[model samples]
Target chain A: MAFATKRLGKELTKLHGSLPPGIELVSAEGFEEWLLDIKVLDANPLYLNQTYRLKFKFSPSYPIEPPEVTFVNTKDRPIPMHPHIYSNGIICLDLLGSQGWTPIQNVESICMSLQSMLTGNTKNERPEGDQLFVANNRRRPRDIDFYYHDNTV
Target chain B: MVNAEQPPDPVRALEFKEKGNKCFQAGDYQGAEGFYTQAISHDPTNPLLYTNRAMALLKLSHYESVISDSLTALSLHPNNMKAHFQLAQAQIALHHEKDALESAKKAYELCMEEVMHGGKGATSLGPIMELVRRCRKEVWEGRERERTRTEKGLLGELVRDLEDRRDVEVQRLEGESAGEIQIEEVRQEYEGKIESLRGVFHRAGEVPRRRVPDWCIDDITFAVMDDPVVTKTGQSYDRSSIMEHLKRSPTDPLTREPLHVSDLRPNLALREACEEFLEENGWAVDW
Candidate 1:
C-alpha cells in the first residue's frame, strides 16, 4: 500500500512528458486524483470535435484496486453519449470495475480504452435507464453489478 | 544526483526547466515543483534545478521538502549560494537552528566573496548578514537545549542502573539470609538423628560404661585398649591382649596362624587416626 504513491508518482512523471494520442492530462496535483481530457480520433458523428473530461480518483490500494473513474462535465467539456455512460457521468465500463482492472492498466491505458470506446461507438444514447439510475444509485461505480453483454464496445 | 540512474539529456532537461520557470512565474508552485522534479530526473547533475524546486516548495510551505531539495542542490554544487540561503530559510522555519546557522554562514561567506570579487556590491550582503546573525543566536540556544536533553537522558540511565544494582544487592542479601537459616535447620535435623541413634545404642546393652569407640577395643579382650599392635596376620590387637594370648600358646586370633610375641608390631598410624577420630567424636565413644 505504501508503494501506491510511488507507483502513481512514476505514472505521473511518465505522463508529464507525453501522453497517448487523443488523451491529454489536464492536471495531476497529487496521488489522490487526476483530471484528463480525451478525444476520439475517428470521425464518429456522435463524438467528433468533442473532448470529454475524465476524473480519476485513486485509493491507497490503487493499481491493486481499480481507480474510480467517471466523466466530469465542465463548461468546455461535455459528457459523451454512450450506452455504457450514464447521463450523470457514471460510466458502466467493465474495465473500470474491480473485476476487469489489472495492475498493468495505467492512466494512459485507461484513457486509450475510453478513446477507443468513443471512436467505435455509433449509438447516440446514454446507458439503459440512465435517468432512473442517476436519481437513485448511491453506490460507487465499482460497487455496481454491471452485466457485460456487449463486449464488442 | 540521486535520480541520475537514467542517462542525462541536457537539452530536454533545459526545456523542462523553462516550463518550470514559467509555471513558477504564473504562481503555480505545485506545477512548478512537478516540472522541476522532471528536470532533475532528466539531468540530476544540474544543481540549479534542485534549487528552483526548493524555491517552489518553499512558496508552497513545504518546508521539509524545501530543506531536502536545497541540501541535494548544495551537495551537487557546494558553491551554489542560493541553495545554501534557501536551506537556511527552510531550516529556520523547521526550527533546526543549529543546521540553519551553518547554511546561513556559508551563504554569507559566498556573498562576501562575490562582492570582494566585484560580482556584487556590499549593499546586497545586508540581508544575508542579518540572517547569519539571527541564525548564530538561535544555534547557540539550540545547542544548549540539546545539551540539556542529553544530560537528562544520561541522568535517567544512571538512575536506572543504580536501581538495578540496588535490586541485585537486596536479592543477594535475602538469598544469603535464607541460606543461613536452611543450614541451621539441617544441622538441628542431623542432631536429632544422632540423639536417636544414641538411645538405640543404650537399649542394645553394648554401650561401654567408659566413653570409648568400638574400633579402640582389643578383639581378643573385647575392651578398649590403651596400646594397639598388629600381628603378623595384619590384625591389630591390644599389646597386653596379644601378649597374654601368646603366653597361652596362641595362634593369631583372627588369622589362626602361628605367631610369637615378636611378630606383633606397633601400628602407630592407625593409633593416630583412632586418636583423631575419638577427639572429634567424643560422644560416639560412649555409643
Candidate 2:
C-alpha cells in the first residue's frame, strides 16, 4: 500500500502533461485527495455548458481498492441531474465500486468514464429515493451498498 | 608565529557545517562541497563533515571522491548509516556491485537496529530499504552477466573443438578415393553444429538497446516485476503486489472474480525474461 503514493505520483505527472477533452485537473496538492473539473463536451441539454467538480479521495490501498469519488457543490457549480446521481453528489457508476475497480484504472480514466456517464444520460432527475438517501444515509459512498440494478445509464 | 598543528576549532566547524547545509538545501552542490571541505578542515576528526562532503560529491557525480569521503566517514563513525548508504551509492555508480550490496546491507541493518531501539532516524528505514533493493538488483545483474560470459566462453570452446576434430578427420582422409566428398560432409556437419550452438547462445550477444518492455512491468505496481505470478484469468502481476491485494480482498484485480492466493501459479518463463532484461537494463528496477 505504500507504493500507492508512487503510482499516484506517476498518474499526477501524466495528468500534468495531457488529459482527455472536457477534463481538467483542479488541484492535487497531495496523494490523499485530488480535485478535477469535468464538463460534458456534447451539447446534452441536461448538462449543457455546466461544469462539475469531482473529488477523488484515495486510501492507502488505492488502485487495488477504488478511490472514493463524488461531486462537490460550489456556488457556481451544480451537481448534474441524472437518475443514477443523487443531489448529494454521490455517483452510482459501477466503475467506482469495489467490485468493478481494477488497478489499471487511473485518475484520468475515471474522469473520462464520469464524463461519458454524464454525456450518455437523458433523464433530468435524480435517483427515485434521492432525498431519503441523502438525508438518512450517513455511510460513505464506498460503505453504502447501493443496489446497482439500473444499467440503462 | 603560525603553528601548523592547531587544535580543531569546533565553533568554526559548526558555522561551516551550517553553511554547507544551507547550500545543500539550496541545490548548490558545488557550494555545499566547498563549505563542507572548509568544515572538515576546521574539524578534521568530525565524521559528519566527511559524510556531508560525500553527499555533495555524490550530487556532483564525482563518484570516486564520494567513495573516498564516505570511506573516511565510515572509518571515523562506524555506525553511521548515512556513510554506509552513501558508500553504496558511490560503489554502484562505479559498478562495484558486490561492495555496493555489502554497504547497502550494512545500512539496512543499522536502520533496522535504530528502529528497534526507537531512535529518531527510524523514518530513514524506507530509503535504506530502497537502496538495499537497488544494490541487490545490481549484484544479481552482475552475476547474470558473469554467467552469460562463462556460457559464451564454453560454447566458443566447444565450437573450436568441433572445428579441430573436423580438420583432423579431413587430414586423415586426404588423397583417399572419396576424400573430397567426405571432407565436404565433415565440414557441413561441423558448421551445422556450430550454427546451432550459436543459436543457443544468441541472446548473450545482445546489447541493451531499449527501455523496459511492457511484458516485464506489473500493472499493479506499474514497476518492473521481480517475481511475476499468473492468476486464473491468465493476467500476470508482481507476486508481492498480488499477494498484498489478496490479503485485503480475495479477488482477481482485473477480472473481479473470486480468486484465492492458492490459484496463483508462478510465471517462471516470464520471470526469466524479466531477469534477462533487468540483467542488461538494470535501471528498469526503478522504472
Candidate 3:
C-alpha cells in the first residue's frame, strides 16, 4: 500500500492523440486502494452526443497487461450489454487477449480500439442470453470467459 | 410451526452459539446477530452470552447496542474485563469521551495488573494497551484540533477548505493542460517526421477537380499509358493508361510483367497508372 504510483495524465492526452472527438478526461486521482478516474467520451453515435464516465482500474501489472476498464456513469450507451461486456465496465478485446496481450499497448491505444469498435459495429445485439446472463452474474466482467464471434461484426 | 424434534434450551443454546460463530466466520454478520440474540435470550445468566452478543453487535457496527449489552454484563458481574473493553469502544462511538476514558482505564488497569503478575498475563492486552493509548490520544487530539480547527467560524473554515480544494484542483488542471501542450508538441514533432501509413485511414471524398500534375505526364512513357497489357517489362501487362507507373519502374523483358512499382508488383499499365497517381497526389508512392 505504501508504494507510490503516479499517472502521467498530461502525457496521455496529446493532440495527434486528439482522441476520437468529444472524449474528455474529467478528473483522475487515487481512489480506494488503487488509482481511478471518470473519463467522459462521446457515446456510440447510435446514442449520439451523450457522455459516459468509464472507470479504469489499472493493476500493478499494466502496460505489460491492459488495465481493467469499464463503464461507470451510465447514460444512453446502455452499458453495452454485449457478450464481451458486462453491466460493469469490463471489455474483452483481441488486444486484451489473455495469451495474445502485447506489452506495448497503453490507455490511449485501448480507447482508440474501443472507439473504432463502437463506430464500425452497427448492431444492437446483446451477448447470447443478455437478460439471463446479467441476472446470473455476480462477479465483475473481467472474470468471465467470452466466446467472441464473427469477424464481420 | 415449531418442530417438535428441535432440541431444548441447553442444546439449542449450544447450537445457536456454534451457528452464530460459523456465520460470523463466513462474513454473515446479520445472521450472526440474529443467532447470538436468540442464544442470549435462551441463556440470560451467562456473562459470556452478553459478551459474545456484544461482540456480534460490535461486528454489525451496532455500537450503541454493544454499549447497552456491555453495561448489562457489568451489572451482572462487575469484574468482566471484556465487558469493560467493549464498553470503552461503544462509549467512543457515542462521543462519550469521559466515559470511554474511564472504561478504557479500567480495562487497561485490569490487564496491566495481570501483566504485572508476571504469570497468566493475557496476550490480548498487548494490542488493547495500544487501543487505550489511541483512544486517549484521540480525545487529546480532538480537543487540540477542535480548538485549532475553529480558529475561524465553522462556515468560514468550510468555505476556506472549499476554496483551497478548488485552488488545488485548478492547479492540477493547469498542470494537466501544460502537460497536454507538451505532449502535443512532442506528437507534432513525431508526426512531422514520420510519413509512414500505419493507422491512417484513407479519407473518402469526391475526386478533386485539380488537373493531374504535369510531372506524371512528362516522366511516364505514352505506350505504357494506352495499353493495359504490354509494358517496359516486355512482360505482358494489364489495365488502361499505366504510363504513370511505367516511367517509374518499366518491367522485366522476358517476363513482360511490370517491374514492382516500388514494392507493389502491379502489371504494366496498372503500374504506370499508380506511378502517375502517387506523383499527382504527392505521396511516397511505395508507401
Report the number of the highest-TM-score candidate.
Answer: 2
Off by over 4 Å in 2: A5-66, A69-153, B1-3, B177-179, B195-287
Q: How would you order the candidates by lDDT, starting with the best?
A: 2, 1, 3
Model 2 TM-score is 0.55
What value does DockQ give for candidate 3? 0.03
Interface RMSD (C-alpha) of each candidate? 52.4, 1.7, 23.3
Candidates in order, TM-scores: namely 0.35, 0.55, 0.32
List DockQ for all candidates.
0.00, 0.40, 0.03
> Model 2, range A32-82, lDDT digits (tens) per residue?
999999999998999898999999999988888889999999977899999
What is each candidate's fraction of native interface contacts (fnat)? 0.00, 0.58, 0.00
Q: Over the stretch B61-125, how does candidate 1's per-residue lDDT look in tens digits? A: 99999988988888889898889989998999888887887888788668757754658535545
Q: What is the DockQ of candidate 1?
A: 0.00
Question: After aligning candidate 2 to the native by TM-score, how far in Å is the CA of A37 from where it should be?
Answer: 22
Q: What is the interface root-mean-square deviation of candidate 1?
A: 52.4
Total backbone clashes of model 3? Answer: 22
